[model samples]
Target chain A: MGEYILAFFMFRYLRLTLRDTEILSKWDKLLQAGMITSAVLLGVEIIFDSVSQYTTWFSYLLLGYIAYLIYWKAEFSQRKSVFVAVLPFVIVSFLTKITSLTSTEFYQSWEDVYDVAGVFSVIWMIVMLVITNKQNKALAREREKTLQEEKQNKIISQMKADLEVQVVQRTAELTKQKEELQQTLDELKNAQKQLIHSEKMASLGELTAGIAHEIQNPLNFVNNFSEVNKELLEELQEAQTNGDLEAVGDITRDIIENEDKIMHHGKRAEAIVKSMLQHSRTSTGKKEPTDINTLADEYLRLAYHGFRAKDKSFNAIFKTDLAEGLPKISVVAQDIGRVLLNLINNAFQAVKEVEKPEVVVSTRHSAEGIEVSVKDNGPGIPQDIKEKIFQPFFTTKATGKGTGLGLSLSYDIITKGHSGQIAVESKPGEGATFTIKLPKT
Target chain B: MKILVVDDERDIKLLFQQRFRKEIKNGEMDFVFAFSGEEALEFLDQLVHEAVLILSDINMPGMSGLQLLERIKTNYLEPPPVVMMITAYGDAENYAAAQRLGADDFLTKPVDFKALKEKLKTLT
Candidate 1:
């Protein structure tokens, strides 16, 4: 039972310390061969009683060889310290048995002590194996935890990369949208400029007939007087040829009067031509100090009459409330005139169909500068359209009747040209008032 | 031949008389003056068929020459006076309108009196 217990401890130590199971299995076969040799040697000693001592010595030697194989040859590194610690005790026990070979009692007592020490060493080996197994399990658990942390770290880095990609993509999309919006704004600005130019041409077309008619009067006088002078000159020559002093004097006096009349009409035509040229010229954008009241009043009547001349049935009640003692404002007169003309013309058009059509032009001294307003008692501007009224190409008038750039051009003149402010206020059914505030010099 | 000259400018009357002074003195040409289209229409009404030629301006304060041309074509059917339309501006629309109103000729200012005299001699 003791040998079997020792063999079990040796098997457990070999299984625990050997790196490969195959090496441990080979050690197992060698252990089995030594144990069978020991049993066969004991059987030979018992069968040949005459050679008992020799067979016993041989068995002892074989047992020491088996101990050397178990302790040194097999892979038992975990139990190596225990084996080294017990080596001196084993040698002392073997020496005690060898020296007291003739003293049977002493030898028997020492063998009993050796058997007890062997049992204690086997118990110590079992305890050491248990400790080594616990240490190995703790190390495996730590390694698994490290692997799991590595996997988590990889996933987190992948997520960070994905987030960076999304940020880059979003920024690119915003930049593209911004570029598209800027392009659209540029196109709109270009279209607005073209519309304003076309509207100006249309207004000039309307003014052409009135200007032509105005120039015709002076031209008629000039032609008529010149022709009459020519006939009078011929008559004066005839009177001189006939030697009639009284007839010659009358004819020469008539020719002089006709020439004076022709000169007067010629100057009138020149004045008309100068004014037309001024109207057609582009603004020099130079500032001049001018009376605000006179400027407002002149443009109002001009616009009103211009509309009336076009349509004979157009009748609008005109009213003015020009404030006295207003300071002169420095502005480009032609640009301001254009703004006023556009506003007044718009007012007249608005009130053309009203039951009590009225157009009121008011000028007054403001705290900062001068304020001019054109008000009309017509169907007022709607809320949705009021905001867009100053935008180019926005109009409520029928096609061919309006170019839709009048108010926009006016806005440009008042705001951008003169550094003034223009705004509109309206009650849907009452009327609309367009106000211009200009700076005083 | 009797002729009616219509224009808003009063100087036109003196002009016509001076240009045809010898003709008027000889009684070869008789000239009458009307200051506007309405006045010319009034003179046309009073004279009925006395005037042989009517020269009228297209633009006037009361009634345009085109309007007068329409009135003359409709009212003066029996031996209608040969009407010539005159305007300061020879615009296509006004020319077409004058023609549509049955004007005998279209003239632009300042009127060519030599051409007028040639046409007049032929008509007479």
Candidate 2:
């Protein structure tokens, strides 16, 4: 009966402790078979008292099966304690069975062995119950720890996902801001291009009167020479009709000379017009081999005459020291012409109030590179504002007289566009000289 | 009459010589040419009373025509030469300024040679 009870409890323990349901179910079926066999044997024992002797062996087989299940299927940690609890009961039973089987006399004399076995079986039951309770408590604590770790892992993953989302959002925002800043910069660049174009037009506007005067002089000559040629031709015809060879020769020479003068003056007028057109048109930024001396001379006269045309009383002795045999440099002619014009105009403006105002434009080929310098004998720039002169919108001129972008634009054209250098040297009360040095390359 | 024609244009000398060829050949009129106001003043300083009439352009480097006129009028008091100012700018301001500075006549270019000749004949 104890064996049957123990088998039932072992089945329950396996059901409770074993994680594999299939294995637990197998153990349950095995235990049921054992109990059914024991029930059958118990029935047989009643029918034939001789079968009672085999009941002990059947109980041993049941105990061995339980031991095998506990040893093989139970958790290694639970197996040791289970074996310790069952060992005393198993040994006591074995001893009782041995005494009963081997020595009938010893068995009758030591009938107390059955009582001892009973006491040990009770202790084993108590130990098994305590160990099961302890294992259950430990399992519950382990399960709680596992649940806590799983929850912490879930929270950490959530925080990581949030951080990734924040990173993406921040990156998106930064990219948008960068795009906006780039757009603004592009707009500003377009505005700057328009401003530079307008400045070029404005300078051309300033030159209009002077260009008119220059062209007018040549045109006047053209008209006058043509009129003179007409008169001379009429005189030559009259002389021819009169048959005076010397007078005819002289008159014919005069007519030819007048025609030549007319052609010369006409060409001059055309050149002036062409230069005016070149100055007014937007630069194509194409570099070509250009004579710097001729460019400097042309712009010097233009700026001088332009200033003189504006203020009739304005006059200065302008000189040119063009170096002979200077090699032509590769440059955008119109751009360099504009730079020269701006510098010469500034020189004229600086020397406006000075007595004996003189401006000198000179070109030279030096070891450094090709250099064009415009020097003036005027009141020089002070040291304080000298460094600021090349900055945009920095002008010492009266308002409305200057746009203040001349030097700054020139600086950009020479340095950024051409990879050159432009510098100003001035001594207070003496004069100022602006020099442009372009590289050979 | 000895006349001094002052202008910055170098071609003016050739043009004047050609225009006044008959007068020059016949010795009826004498002409002197100076390319700038300073040159004209230098010529006048050398030959004090040789030139009786001076035709000067108002715009020239180193010395303007008006400044030259002022100097000529102030310095040459005795038998001062008739000073005529010519300018491309026909503005009233220049005319008034020239007049104020003792310019005997003011003319705008392109100068009408016919009218100028008639004016010169009347002056003579």
Candidate 3:
């Protein structure tokens, strides 16, 4: 049985290491020889129970085969071969029993070699167990570290996703708030413009009143004397008719020349007073039903004359289209007059620097409202500042030339005072149209 | 009748003389001109009796017509001269102020000559 266990172990070792057909055949032959010898020895021990000396010789042959295996596989694995070499001593007590059967003296002499071989086998087993335990512990530690890295990566990705979501939400909120702030800024700018425009209008009104008062005195003298001279002329003619020829010549000459001076200056003063009244009349506060066509036509001519007084060489082709039979609207005539003046003045300025300057003022009665448009052939407003044009103190004119309150005041007069609408349309190189729409109500 | 015309304009002296030449020639009326309120007051101080009428322009370089009217009403109490206030602006405020200041009449510039003649006739 012991020989069969050794043969089985040798076969397992040969299957693990022997890949060459030549090495495999040698191992197979040695294993067969060991098995046949052990079988024959077992039969001899059964037949001659007293003659076991031959069994000891068979164990020595087995030990010699194990030494040969150790020498042959030494280069393959030194540690495994050393462990296998010690395994042969596990059956050393059976070898001693067979040697005792042969001669007691021979058994006593081999006892020390068996003990040393048994100790080597025990040491090999302990070393193998320690190595295996350490390998297992290292493998478990590596698995745990990999697991921890994977968990940390999952948490980081989750945090990144949450941060992205929060950023998106915050960006949306900021964008909405920014839009609201921008809207408030626009409203504040509009209010500031309105305040500046009213201030300018107040100063302008005062200046106009001063001029009116100053001019009226000279105008009064001209008219008074002109009337008195007319009476004097009639008296002089009546005197001549009664046949007073000697005194008549001097009187007629003096009176006629004086009448001419009176009439000439009288007409000049009248024209100036009329122009001043046309432009500078204070608003009456109460609404009056008025013919819009007459108001527009009168103001257009007055504005033209006013511009002419400033720039003697300025000339423009002015056209008007007054819708006939339009219903008379109730409005504060002087206030509406001021609005018309501002729009017409702006139109004139717009066309001043352009070739073939033309200003067309047109009125139309429509289902929407009373539409008045002041169109000019001039370099139009640019797109960027188009929305800001009506803001107070926003002017394209040279400083000191314009107060920049004309359009702003006009906007207030039309939109707030009259509950009307004013809008502009323009292209960069083309002309511009400013339309004022007053509701019929 | 003698009338005092107060104004700062030098041209007014000629204008009045020319306008009333017929009346002056017929000896029906005479005009004494004062260029300022001070001159008018000085002229009134020298006169034994106040002029039959006084026409003064409201806007003058020195003393205004309203101030002259105040002085005339206070200084000449015996036969209070018919002091008419004339201004270039016929605004309500100036008119009201002149009337409140004891002006006998208020006339806007380019005075209606016929209207002035009638007022003068009635007063005479």
Candidate 4:
């Protein structure tokens, strides 16, 4: 109802401003209405008449309209609040007006305005405190979130750096291992080449020596026969010139006899040379199941012949312990032949210069394989050189006497080629023994 | 019969000449000298068995004793003269190779004269 009254009064004021057609004209009407309402209410109360009371009630209606106009026009900072701040001035205006009307009854009207204003003011203070606390907590929460983000970013960067360093370290380690393996492989290839070359040279050496011995027997007879034939031919010429018929027959018989001898020895020489050529031409002859005892014996003879040609005084006595019931191994006859030849020859040479020259070749059967050993009664290999002997190009023999590749190549052939194992047992003075073991098939 | 000793080194030739002096003086043998393996081979090729034994030293600067030995054995099968190879290196592998190429005997140098005489006796 009071809001209705306020709307009515603002409309009348707006009419006055518009109709008067001047800004000052609206303010003159607003002041006139205020003074008339105040004076009319005072006169009615003084008269104590019911008819005038109705006219005085219009004054309250006018006050509600004026207050509404002022509330609408107010700024937040400069204007008094409608419900709280303005209530004090409004109570003061209501009191002074009532007091002018009835000076004794003024306290009763003052209490009504004071109650409305005081209640509104207390409500305003509670709302202000709540808004302030919420804004402050929001700001504090935003700062905490930003700090957490910074800490997360720092940790992530550190992890990235650590991962990069670890990757680099691992890559370097792999590269080092790769280089080391490559270097080892290169060295192994070089050693393999030298071993092959030495093996070829050794076989060629054997071929030549075999040829030399083979040719010697036939060549002798040829020399003897040709000389005798030449002598006989000359004598035959003399006999014809001198006219000795009987002497011619003798010369003829002598030439014929020498011719037979020539054929006999020449054929022997041819067969031997052909065989030596065939032997050297082929690499690692067809493998066969060969009795280890037989191979040992044959190579032992050849080794003996080879060494005897070099140094006749090196008559090292030989002994063999051929095991019975031993299995015949499938082997490349010539390759194994060469290995045995090298070992036996070395053994013989080792023993030849010793006080009592002696060599022993022995064969035995073991669970792993067939073991063949050649031992000598020579001054044993020095401890240092024993290990070195198995290395390519390492030799204990005097320079030019031994191509150190012999044993190293033998080791490869035995271990890698035949899938066998070779070991040496030696002492400084007792002697040395070389043993080769082949897996039992 | 006479055997020619051919080598570059004076020591090797002198050793051969001195070692066989007794047989040479007795008219049982005679010695001739050539300075190189080539000269030795040439002399032998000409005279055939006049030099029944050609003891040669390998490792000469030109035309090694081994080359001479090979030539002698391959070319002249008839009465192929006995060739004993001598070297400072008693390399058995070398010996085997020499023997394979038709070397009758092999000797390491600083040769004991007595051993040489015995080898010659077998050839004769």
Candidate 5:
């Protein structure tokens, strides 16, 4: 009965192990049939009191077949223990059946042998069950570890994907900010260009009256000479009709001289017009060799004459101390011309109220570079506002009298554009001097 | 009669010589030129009462025509020379100042030489 019970439990274990395998399911069914047959044969011998040798042999054969199936088809870790557990039962049953078949006298001894083998088989089965239980527990712990590793791997991958998304979002935001900054920079550049143009126009407006006077002087000469030439021609005709060859020759010479004067004055007017155009035109930012002395003298006269045109009572004695044979410096002529004009105009304004107003413009070329200075004999700048003069929109003049951009623009032209320096020296109640220094390169 | 023409423009001397060529040739008028008010004063000082008429530009660099006129009216009292002020700025303020300074006449530039010649003829 104990052997039957062990066989039934072993059959159930094999079925559980081979449940999902199609090939192993046949072994499971076979083990179940063997267990049932063994039980029925045992019941027939016990109840009918007649145990046929054939029936006994058949039952032992069925037990051996089930033991082989368990050894062949069970899970690898539990296979050895399960096969060993059923081994003792199969050997004992077979041995008992064989001895009974051999001789009747040996049947009694075989029965004793059978009982001892049964006891040993039961003990072996219990030991194999404990070993199989330990193996299953180890296998279950290994499976749990593998499952935990897979879960950690999935979580790590998810975090990496999230980080990539954050990086992409940050990159897009930076790109948008960069584009906005570039757009703002473009707007500022356009505004700077407009301001430069407007400032040039303002200076041109101040020069209009002076330019008119400059052109008018030459035009007067041209018209007067032409009128004189007409008279000389009439005089020549009279002399010819009178048959006075000497008077005719003299009058013809006079007409020639008058024509020369007209041509000279016409050329002068043309030059003044060209300069006016140059002053008003926008700068092209091209550098050319320029004579600092000539520019200084020209702007000095322009500023003086401009002031005179506006206020006939405003008069100043201007002098020049230009260095002879000074080497020409490369510069943007229009921009430098604007700076000189602004400086000279400032000097004129400084000396407007002085009793004997005097403005001196000087240019010098040294080993270092070229220098242009404008000095005035008037109330000099105070110590406090001297530093603020070059700052944009800083002016001591009345609101409408000065644009305040004159010195600031000049500062930019000399410093930023040309890589030059501009400075001022003044003694209050005495005089002020502005100096511009430019590099040779 | 001798006439003094004062202007800062050096070419005024040539212009005057040519414009009054007939008067000069006929010995009806003699012309002298000074480039500035200072030069005109120096000339008047050297040759007292020699010039009968003075034609001057108002907008000179050092001494203006009005200032010169004032000096002349104050200093040269024995039949002060007739001074005519000329300027490119024909504004009323200059005209009033010249009149107040005892100017004999005022003229705007692009000076009408024909009218000037006729006016000079009456002066002669």
Candidate 6:
């Protein structure tokens, strides 16, 4: 049935209509059925007629019909060699049947000829099956390898993307930190600028105040002396007019005394004004040869007087051990004086609360320079705040009572302004000693 | 009426004394001197507003001119004597504090003699 339908299916196979695949599969099955039928018939004829038990030749005819059917269904018309090969197979199959019925000897004579051909064909078929099976297994392994490689690549791509994201985040964080550090640096610079400006203004204010203080005293003296002179003049004129010569002499003597007093006051005030002006002028870093001992004594006395003048009721003894052979030092006299003043003032204030306060000012020549120290037997600065004393605006004084600029300004004057060294040693309740050293000239 | 000149500096008080010497002797005004604000106040306690005018330096030790002026204004309000606060520096904060404390006038050094005279006239 399939052999008869092979021509119709072949047209459909060429056109590739949707129904063609089913039709072709059905035709192949039909052809396969015919081929099996032919094989069965040939087997039946050989097995039954081996002793010539089947007297009929219809079996061979049946095999021939089956072969023809297989040929028709398989569309082997275009393969003429297949028909040629099958004809010989059919002939041998018939001859084998005839010989099996005749005798075993005749069957053995043809066996050797067909056996090799059969063996070769069988080996070729086995080779084809093995090749097909190996191709399927090899395709499966290759597909599996491709899938595994693709998975690995995907994982790598994900890791790369994640790493890129992390790097970007870290870079952004670093940039932010750098900007913050830069901003902090800017703030510090601004604060430094502000502090220096404030210092300049304070120094200028002090200078102006000092000048005003000095000028006021002398101008007052001039006005007072002139008035006194006028009074004396008028009194003398009155005595002269009345002819009381004795009164004139008395008034004249008073006038001279007042004049002398006037001169004395004028000179003192002038000295103060000039000193203030010199203080405000520019100073270079070059050290001048100065009598360190004299400067020390003057500043110590000035410090004592400054405190004594403020609180007259307090009587505190001051001991001085000024060295006699101390050599002059190279320093800025004014700057060193400021440091001495700061140290002395601190000493005095520290001892102000003590029952029996004594300040010891000692001078000696050191290997490095002339060493001068102001020591006080009073409460000392705390260890924690010792370093902070040199910091600007760090003060222990009550507001408005002290400007807190004293020690900081002194530190700058001695270290930077005079090229000298100042140090402090203190113990709580025992006392503090501030030592200053200037290089010997 | 007598006038009191209070200051720490001897030169300042003497200066005022010299400038007004003629008037003081002519029975126009008698002068008392106090070297400090404390001394001036002590004198005030004794004399009880004897001075119709008080010339004071603002920066003296013990008691400032403003403090003394406040005391006088509060304790002795009736016929409150005129107080002319004299300051070496014309510090605005101090001047403002003085004025707020009822200072009669504020003067900056070096004192203008003519201005002093005018202030004296107003006080008298």
Q: For this target, which candidate reaches the highest DockQ against the unseen true structure?
A: 2
lDDT of each: 0.73, 0.83, 0.70, 0.67, 0.82, 0.66
- Please state every model's RMSD to the true fold in angstroms: 10.2, 6.7, 20.1, 17.7, 6.8, 14.3
lDDT by residue for model 5 (A192-240), tens = 7776677777777777788788788889999998898888888888999
lDDT of 6 by residue, A1-441 (tens): 212222223233322322335555655555455445545544565677563345235445544554564467454343333334334444555666577678778778878765664455445444643564466467658868888888988988998999899999999999999999999999988986565445434444533533455456666776668776887898889999999989889778868867876887787666555444444454444567777666666555545545644554344556578888877777766566556766876888889998778888889987877888999988887998888988777878777555666777777877776667888899888889998776664
Tens-digit lDDT track for model 3 on A253-274?
A: 7667666666765665565555
Model 6 per-residue lDDT at A400? 56
Q: What fraction of the correct interface contacts does each predicted structure contain?
A: 0.36, 0.52, 0.24, 0.00, 0.52, 0.36
- Every prediction: chain A TM-score: 0.56, 0.72, 0.42, 0.49, 0.65, 0.47
lDDT of 5 at B55: 93
- DockQ (CA atoms), all models: 0.20, 0.64, 0.10, 0.04, 0.59, 0.17
Model 3, residue A192: what's the lDDT? 70
Position B46, candidate 5: lDDT = 74
State the displacement of the C-alpha of residue A253, model 4, in Å, after optimal TM-score superposition. 21
Give lDDT tens digits, candidate 2, residues A1-441.
455455545545655665555555655566567666656655666678776676757766767776776677644345556656766776677777788899989988878868777696878768786986798689879988999999998999999999999999999999999999999999999988888888888888878888888888889888887777777788888888999999999988887888888898899788778777887788888999988987887788778778987887788989899989989889988899899999999999999999899999998888867999999999999998898999998888789777889999999999988899999999999999999999877
Superposed Cα deviation of residue A302, candidate 5 (Å): 2.4
User: For candidate 1, lDDT tens digit of each residue in A85-194?
Assistant: 34444454456546567777776767777667666665555565466556656655876788788888888888889989988999899999999999999998887666
lDDT of 4: 0.67
Per-residue lDDT for B4-117 in model 4, tens only?
A: 676655433433443454577587667777778668767877786454677776644346677778888887776667778876557767788788888887887545566767
Real contacts retained, model 2: 0.52
- Candidate 1 chain A TM is 0.56
* TM-score (all chains, Cα) for each model: 0.51, 0.79, 0.42, 0.42, 0.71, 0.44
Residue range with the least summed lDDT across 10 consecutive positions in model 2 chain A: A74-83
Cα error, residue B51 of model 2, in Å, equals: 4.2
* Model 6 alpha-carbon drift over 4 Å, by segment: A1-205, A227-242, A277-332, A340-382, A388-441, B49-52, B113-124
Model 3 lDDT tens row, B1-124? 6789998776687677777676677877778999988899898887747456899987653466877888888878877788888876666877887889899889987677768877876776
